[model samples]
Target: MRNDEVLVKVEGVSKKFCKSLKRSLWYGAGDISRSVLGLKNPEKLRKDEFWAVKDVSFEVRRGECLGLIGHNGAGKSTLLKMLNGLIRPDEGRIEMKGKVGALIELGAGFNPVLTGRENVYNNGAVLGFSKAEIDRKFDEIVAFAEMEEFIDTPVQNYSSGMKVRLGFAVASQMEPDVLIIDEVLAVGDLGFKIKCFNEIYRLIENAAVILVSHSMPQVAQVCRTGLVLKQGKINFGPGKVSNAIINYFGIFENNGLNIEGNRRGEIRNFKFGNNDTSVELDISKNQNQPEIILENCQNVFFETSVIIEPSVENFSLIISITDIDQKVVAQVTPPERMFTNLTKMMVVEAKVNSLMLNTGNYSISVHIYNKSNAVDRGEILIGIRNILKFTVKKQKFVGAAPILYESRWKEC
Candidate 1:
């Protein structure tokens, strides 16, 4: 809470894990034995052990947010656990300057048998607040979580989304000097996510935060500094999280095209273009780019060019719009088209009339399906996830199901 404090400092940190569960347990026993005996080479890896995090280091000062991003098993979760003190780094040092609040795993510290309200108080107390202090902020936390009706329910009966809401509510409202949140934001609905983000923005005024999310836009929205971990090493340094995002997505080799893997066709190019307007998207950039902002209630033009070889006969384009939280907004695509040509370039276009989505960034995935002659069924050939992305803004807070449906006044 002091001015210009260094809330978290990680130095040459590394952690290792065993591939097999039984070996992992054995490794843990060996580690404890070595520690008790003050043995040397304790950090050395065993035959079954692999480095989850290796020589990674970073510092977060007051009023700063650090972003951690990588593919699954790239040591993101391991680094977060080390930062939260849930797991110790096999080597190097981690220093915490003040009270730390971490929302690491989903419902990590909650007592399943206790009621949600009771868990709130318990968490608040653990964060160093008195009973009277928790009492003063309890209503605000419950209201922010929108769990007023279910606050008294046992956590065992609560859904995963409910647990996320309550966990985020308590952590964000606890006023910790250091805040660390993993990918828990994906569980809550859009409304709660927006509220949670607002709270994070407010909390960073005098605190330091570390956030990890697969969605680049979400990380760019909250954090100014970033790190890209690749195979247990820090591939990118802090500062300019946008560049870090490009680097993370750029890891998709072969020009970001999935042509070889079990597929009936190849996506030559995917872009957003409107013939009537000058709004043309260069597909070479990262998905959900900053240059593709569009106004709501306007037509969204999408074009995907595909090439199918002789083996596969018929195919169609199935495009899906997914928001930053990885929620499927709509499977908006062009009318069905059956093409029988082989090694021919075919362009598929979709015109979404009056885009009803609320203000946020969305990614478009191009999925090609082929009707297999052997099975007489439509099988997914090639799926290019998050091929393109765009931002939408200048809208009020609306409920889920972003599209606006056609309506007319009728007598009931």
Candidate 2:
């Protein structure tokens, strides 16, 4: 591969599908008639056609790992298929700079009847590996997959995890010019998933990779640039991974795609408390303290945005804090605080001063409500929940709650 040339160039790619099987039948008939007439059907005749992918174009340079992210059926898989040559675009072209090895599906090229050893060679040969090359890398593939004992076993008998491991091992070992993987890491155990992630990162450092995953954290850690896919097209990306994640979720949330169309807004990037030790006041140390008192209730709340139903208007999220006994300690209404209409994620601080309580183990409950009352969501106590817990030590205080104030006696 040249040092400065683009590895893959996708230009004006679009894929369309007929809505129903009946429409597809008509499409076939139209194609036959057009072929016989040495002409094509009028573009208006295919107006009923739905575009699964629309006018998508991008160029991937050599040695760049690009992330493709979207909800299910968002054309991400279709785009990958086009790039892998498994499917052709209805309009436009994809130019590859080198041999493309795509693990588009687990056991995609493996023969069920063939032994693991045979399938490896079969796939390797198809991937343009020489016989000697396959032989040299055969043991390494088995070792990396940790499937040495199953080498002679027919691939059909291997478990799904084993198949994934072997497929990844074989594909990575062959050193393809470009590797396109589609959510393969979503499967497998945690240990194997971590191993796969590390291996993919290593591959990115040396070559180009297109990673597709449902986990945002995984993508944020792996890719520097990402493409967000909307309904059936590559929407927007090439920005921060967090933005990509928010965009990916926004597509569904805006479309009323949640279960039963509950139409609840999303909670993004929630950090429970401050990291400093001083900020994390542990009142638990004072068993002598009669009541569980939260020293600093100021630093607790789930911060996010709220989108109302039907209108989908954005509202600043409101949070209310309660004691383990379901006592409403403090309520922070964003609208009342002059923070009503929020177009994006905004930071809000909730504080409860002078929390009086009888010293005992207590829990915290959280309630989230929209400004319009269209959505009211709260976390119910299953057993004992942890939001904030602090103990009050018995001291020379007059009030039932712990409070300190300077007092002086003067002659009248």
Candidate 3:
């Protein structure tokens, strides 16, 4: 229980992979043959061999959580395996102290033929827990997993979700010195995911937890220290989780705004920032869709900058939010907020205190219109058709409607 205790330490650890199956088998055979003869190959490259993780290093201390983030083949999984001792590093060393509980892969260590209840006891025994200890914790794991009906079923018969639930339940119950969870939690339902999050947080007071995830917000929430990997290289060192997240986003410089039509005004920028972090379109530009939160802890606001040309008027500002399928989730038109006359150039902004939308990406279109006219079908002064987007990431009330907080969205 000393403050200087380091739970997990990975220093200069690296793993290599072969591009061709034939090369991999040949390399394995050569290495095994050399080991039997007490001989070592001096040549480093054996054709098609490349480092999946090269010279990566980090430390996770007790009571601290570390986030590992990157793209699909960023070596995060390989590093996790090294931490769990499932694979040995091609070079360097990994020092891990105390009992480690890892939910690395779905149903990784469980026997397919054994019943869930039997596996629970067997795995606990493998983890150095006595029979009596497993007996005492068996029911709690089952109840937390909500898998009492299938507790007696064979492990092979359980679905992915069921296996993940059972795995997390077991890991969470066991107070290990280190808890490592890869992308396995992404398969579970929303409620279970939230529950597991809370459980992991509680464990943070005593154990060091390592989380590998592709979701930025999830990593930002759980970990204080961050490690970013890209193509087997250390891109960003362990630092503030927030800054690491932005670095991991790989967005630099102002990628021009998406706009269309020769409208009355030139929409220069549509950006958002708050007291904590500011994502300006001029600097860090998001992808096709951005996200918004309603009165969340972070003070977030959206500002629209535009330059009006000459004298253009009698057009209403129409803003519409639609889903991917082009269905109008919410539509609002501020009646009589029309700019009847413009002197030279201007910037107009419509700010919302807070909003609550569904988790999916919602496309936003800003348009200037003058009520339906007989001469023309489209009265768009300037139409940025689905040019920008926002996301509502909070998943809640899954079985019911997605549209909550009706008051936030002014119904047409």
Candidate 4:
């Protein structure tokens, strides 16, 4: 086959399931009878039935990878199962060319009673490999999985990580024409995951790859294209991976404020923005977190009023900016000397000369820490997470870095 050949083509594919097992069995029997009588099954959903995947269409060519991403039960697994030929689509056609390898579930193809060594050969044979072919790659698979010691042990006794290691090693080593990997890699240790990704990078150069992961970074790193599923339908992109990730984050936005800290202090009011735009957060009136939208490198400011207990003397205010994944991307803290005076109620203000975050969704976390010394931010008097969210619009450079620094270039 040519390198640019389309290895996987899914056209208007959809799958549905009945909510009740009895209903599902009944539906299955009826469908089977209809098929035997040269009749077509109903395309529309019947009672107690819902679409798991609906009218999804995309094609993957050799030397390309497609990232399928969504929240749990968004039909990602059902779509993958259909692609792997483990299940049939109810409403659409799927065409896959050449050999296909899938690691859809943890230890999916593994035999519980069989030793790791035996299962390796069994999987290889299932992939159309002969005994001698499996023997040639046997040691490499063991080494890659780092399961040399446990190769003779029954798979049923293996840990989750061990099973994942062996399963990935076999699937990847066989070098099938089309490879489908689900989130099973999450079970492996960090070091092993890194090795597996390196192997995947190599594999995608010659094979069509379909990756399903909730980890946006992993999907961005591996897939050239992406598709986001929401409630059994396409929410965004069979296009750029970045946009798909953005849409995926957008789906879960407006999650209300989360606060964690001692009861010594309470935030009365909070607001942030510049002259052109501003957002005030009202916990009483609005249950959803408010969002601030700004262009890259814009100046922004924050102000908050807090009421403290009589026992509170010296304290420092901490502002943290976190990404969609709730990972701290930036933090701001006032100097210790700034809190010299003691007061029961106070208003605090902070300014950012230039906000350099890349285009993405982010949230602010406000923390009031007790300050005893110059170095120690002793303990949290009050901490409010997801106080409000924000988004930095796309700029000239759309790299993955959380913070985008402006740099000047000189050509020699």
Best by the lDDT measure: 4
TM-score of candidate 4 versus the correct structure, residues matched by position: 0.87
TM-score of each: 0.66, 0.62, 0.71, 0.87
lDDT of each: 0.80, 0.64, 0.75, 0.88
Global CA lDDT of candidate 2, please?
0.64
Better of 1 and 4 by lDDT: 4
Q: Give, for candidate 3, the lowest lDDT window spanning 10 residues.
A: 277-286
Q: Quote the lDDT for 314 in model 1.
A: 75
Model 3 alpha-carbon drift over 4 Å, by segment = 41-43, 251-412
lDDT of 3: 0.75
Evaluation by lDDT, superior candidate among 1 and 3: 1
Q: Which runs in model 1 stand beyond 4 Å of their true positions? A: 1-3, 255-412
Question: Model 2 over residues 1-412: C-alpha lDDT tens digits?
Answer: 4644678888989877787889889897887799799985555427467877877887776667788988888888888889988877877888987667778887788999999999999989998889999999999899988999999999999999988888888888887778888897566778878887788877775567888998766776788678898877667866655567656755653312112223354332223332222222222232222223444433443333223333434344444445323345544555533334355554555543333433322333333333334354333211112334344334433542222333588999
Model 1 quality (TM-score)? 0.66
